[model samples]
Target: MKMDGETEQLHVVLFPFMAHGHMIPTLDMARLFAARGVKTTLITTPLNAPTFTTAIQKGKNTSRPPLINIQVFRFPAQEAGLPQGCENLEQALGPGVMDQFFKASAMLKEQLEQFLDKTRPDCLMAGMIFTWATDSASKFNIPRLVFHGTCYFSLCVGEILRLHQPYKNVSSDQEPVNTFLLPSLPHQIHMTRLQLSEELWSNKETDYKKRSSKVKESELESFGVIVNSFYELEPDYADFFKKDLGRRAWHIGPVSLYNRSNQEKAQRGKTSSIDQHECLKWLNSKKPDSVIYICFGSTIHLIPSQIHQVLMALEATGQEFIWVVRNEDDLGGFEQKMTGKGLIIRGWAPQMLILEHEAIGAFVTHCGWNSTLEGIAAGLPMVTWPMFAEQFYNEKLVTDILKIGIPVGAKKWTTVPSIEDVIKQNAIEKALREIMEGDAAEERRCRSKEFKNMAWKALEEGGSSYSDLSALIHELRGLSTKNHN
Candidate 1:
């Protein structure tokens, strides 16, 4: 843990799931360890290493960027289910494969063993899909931690709830609509019937429990967990994870916040994504807390109608705002028509900065874990429009339970998708206006202020988040020492 004591840098190996969602956050975490003068090697499939390294290189525009000196190492993956040139874990999980998850993990374990034998690292940090990573850490006699991409509150609850058999399968009379308020927290969480209505053997059910839980159990039985969150914002939930769950958990986020202060990262050559300066220029012109930032997390698919309606609603509201429409096809002529009131960025965004901006008012988010946490850190009220996955659960927390935000347009629980589902621009306009004005707006803003204070406190010098991170490093160091002895 002492930077001064090292002869060189301590070597740490990182392996993230192949999905972009997992890749970005885990890459962010690896960047943190690397930023601290630690020598880090990001271990992944050969096919992915080049692309990831390119992204990292792009993110670290060299000249004054606080560079994450991470080396990328690729281990060969068996090409059975994987597509050509797609040697990543995701490639392994492709069609015509059964138990591909475990098989891929087993192959990775062998690859890691060979790599570690040649290039020893002090610790191993992995994605939730790398079910054998903890074991690999143990085999190598190194410290281990799993990188989680969700809000710990959401992750903890989702993992536990997944254990229960489907309540939707039971007779309506015999079943109770499932709702439980979190203990020691100020929110209630429930499962909607739509969520319950998915097929019993669907791929959704398989991914959530079979693969995700397997990864979770592997991590739990290992060293600890490293989360991208600070403790103050979700104190009760963080406490539960550490104390009741009996896991060593560290919260060192908003990771993107540190990136803001990291002048070195700003100049990075490659990924310096989207035109940030231009984006901010547009944002600068908007009223404080007046703009609605709408974006679904990457990888979500939405109908064209859904996007068109949301666009018109923003247009009808005539509110000055920044809209991050990743897919431009749905907007039609809305961007050109509502020229003065809107700004749309084509691709990736400096999301944390936008949320933290003085002029921004609300977030129209896809309810992904990363966006949700970032939004909370910035103290912005939300307009929940869950696309799919665990997002529905997160939407429940944000709207139904937290009271800090509400759903967009229609009521979630009972509303059936009508023919007018996509064209209800007035409904979108009304929802936007309500959350941005009157008593409701003031109350939500006050709540945001309360959370902001808590977030600052969590990241302060000896705060829970800092201490947890320090502890994880210390524990890993101890493991290294014992190995030497």
Candidate 2:
């Protein structure tokens, strides 16, 4: 399908899950398409559109104005039994509203299909949760590509574990301390059953499993999977996803680094609600690689007890720290308790900017995929305190595979209450020390640096990730050409 020396227009629609972690990376992917002269449209709800404004403005500021359109649709909040504006996962903070959020999300299907019919996009690229988009794309004879915001390592491990259920044989009582070895990995990977999410270990039926099954089915029916990972960073795992899954897959990321707004400006207007300058100034006062930056990505809700324990641990370390306080109630005047010791951002913080700062010695993270990739890009070792979802799997990658982190010894999943293992101040202190100043910290730091180099190289021209992006764009253009003829 030659273009006769003329560039044929290819329009791609990006429909990401409402979570910020999902939105940010998918937006970056859209920017990549725009950078290559592909027309892109990001379909989002009215409430979520504002979040993309700063990044969109940043794209326009650059010489080549990204042909990225912002298509906002009305959310069915009332129908879903949610408040008028509660369209996103972050806004629905309580567990009760999760079903409502999904209900609203499902309602978008009709509008999205109508939008697709009107616009006739060359392809639809959507988050894993939007499983219905595959069928929508099929109606138009268009390809629907599933975008997974995590790395190839976590994805492979998750798929393998799901199929084999190796942990199934491990007794429930023994899971608290016992380790289960995964059978068919290039490297030996072992984890306690407790390390997995509670739902995975449950014997009864769950809505989670039902939802996950749909996502899995959607992936099997989709054109391919677009993952936010780099080839050099996980060569073996990347190969595993491509070969074993028998699916077209592209490892074209750490996509956050590609957008200037995300990497350089802290995304200005669209970033944290708190002040960025104050935090950066405080970071300037600290020594190189001496500050620990702590943040849990948007979805994780920490109990007050856990928050207190984290505060005590940070204070005990006596190290300079920066913490993102999501819930004001959780702080309980801890800011005054540690006045000169650390800085606290009241709301969201510019995570990428903070991670990239030279003063960041270690990260205390929830092990979210976005945070994990950002930490790797920054070359900082971590203190992994996984809360929920694929975070525990990501923790395994960081602690076992990458060898760039120390676990905070959270024995049970935070989302469910099968058994609560309070991560004590002493355990937190020890994990912080191991990542910051322990004997193996140097090795971890060196490994982090190596990954950082590879991450950058993967994005460079002629690199693996770079080639994957190019191939994807070419394939999409060919699809459009074929559809037209």
Candidate 3:
């Protein structure tokens, strides 16, 4: 339905949690809304203010400039119980981090009161961590929209499906919950006990039975939720989010689609971000679509044990690849560990550029939300190597539901883990080779292109995402203009 309003002018606020993954995408969304003439106030901690600004700098469409104003609100540290300079949600490291997040929420309420007192934003869109938003929004008589910085499939598993319900705080030493059922999800999408953790399951300090139980309550109550995916990508999941959850869901991604397009135009035929590897040149040197791209995302830590296993697997397989690894210090024992016919870049790679390169055939990813979307947007197939909490869920959607990626659900962060599913090294190599060079590769390419087109249409004028955003702007204007009489 079209939103009934005089003009689509809105005085909106954007508040994302202070992390690269969370803040960057929210900033892009803010830019999109601002471009559409929404008066956008983006709220962030001091640390992230610069991060968002840098992203805007990259969006180089000066002719059609960003159409919104960004406002920053700072919450006190000790009061919010966060150590000063906490850039991203530390609580994300493990379940032990939840208490800190809870404390941060209490702190935000105090700081937010001062913020609202000075400037009344029409409505608030917050990162999901600030679960106390309903209380604050109600106090100010404004709607609060919580943005889940992940795939809808992951959120559904987190929200409606309760996929982790059965293993509430079970001992890890015991057999894990591999291949569990979800309430609303298709059987093709399955999860294992390896993904479940005690922190997500148990509320150690609170009276609540589990941490996820509290998470569930919050999921039920938000005024609206925004996910960085489109309906065409996962129609069944999208439908489940709306019809079953009784809430509004807008699939406005892959967000990188709009961002990559904007940045490519801005850079104007120049290389951007990290240095371009000869990997592209090398891949071009080989036959069509012959290289594998492997990356574990920004926040993952690689201890020596983990590195050794990967080295052995590659050395045994004898396949060529391109790998990106970011670590705290220099390769501690790396020379002895990885002896394979492959190139390893020690830091960040110009991911958008590399993915767009024709030589790159398959992505071996951690399945972090951003990486997953980028892989899709660039039309590359994936070899899923999920690392943390919701990534297992995301892996299932990509490999199982979407059928564009392969799920290699090995949770062993290192090759030397005592317990593993024991898929042979040859099997792993064969899988990689098959996906990159065989009929499987072609099928994946077709599906990847299919979703990419859907994402493009959703962002263009008159598409579902475009219409949803316009409606949001229209509603915001009505709220901004009308007195609540």
**Which candidate comes out best when scored by lDDT?**
2
Predicted model with the maximum TM-score: 2
For 1-485, candidate 3 gives per-residue lDDT tens digits of: 22434233456787777666787678778877777766677777665566656655655445556755556666455565556655465324544454565566557766776676567777888877776766777677777788878876777777643543754433453444344555455454545455654344444644333445555555567668878877677777777767876667777776666654535422322233344445455656654466678888766665555555565666666556777776344555654554344667665566766676777777888888988988887777898877665777778788877788876646532322343444455555666766776687799888887877777888888887788777777666666667343
Those runs of model 3 whose alpha carbons end farther than 4 Å from true positions after fitting are: 1-8, 58-61, 78-83, 90-98, 161-178, 186-188, 200-211, 260-273, 276-288, 315-320, 329-343, 411-428
lDDT of 1 by residue, 201-251 (tens): 244665435665677678778777778877766676777777766677788
Candidate 2, 323: how far from true, in Å? 0.7
RMSD in angstroms between candidate 3 and the native structure over all alpha carbons? 4.6
TM-score of 2: 0.95
Alpha-carbon local distance difference test for all models: 0.65, 0.83, 0.66
Comparing 2 with 3 on lDDT, the higher-scoring candidate is 2
Query: How many Å off is the CA of 402 in candidate 1?
Result: 4.3
**TM-score to native of every candidate shown:** 0.83, 0.95, 0.83
What residue runs in model 2 are displaced by over 4 Å at the alpha carbon?
1-8, 175-178, 261-264, 268-270, 416-419
Q: Relative to the unseen true structure, what is the C-alpha lDDT of residue 118 in candidate 2, on a scale of 0 to 100?
A: 92
lDDT of 3 at 407: 61
Provide the global lDDT of candidate 1 against the true structure.
0.65
Clashing pairs in 2: none
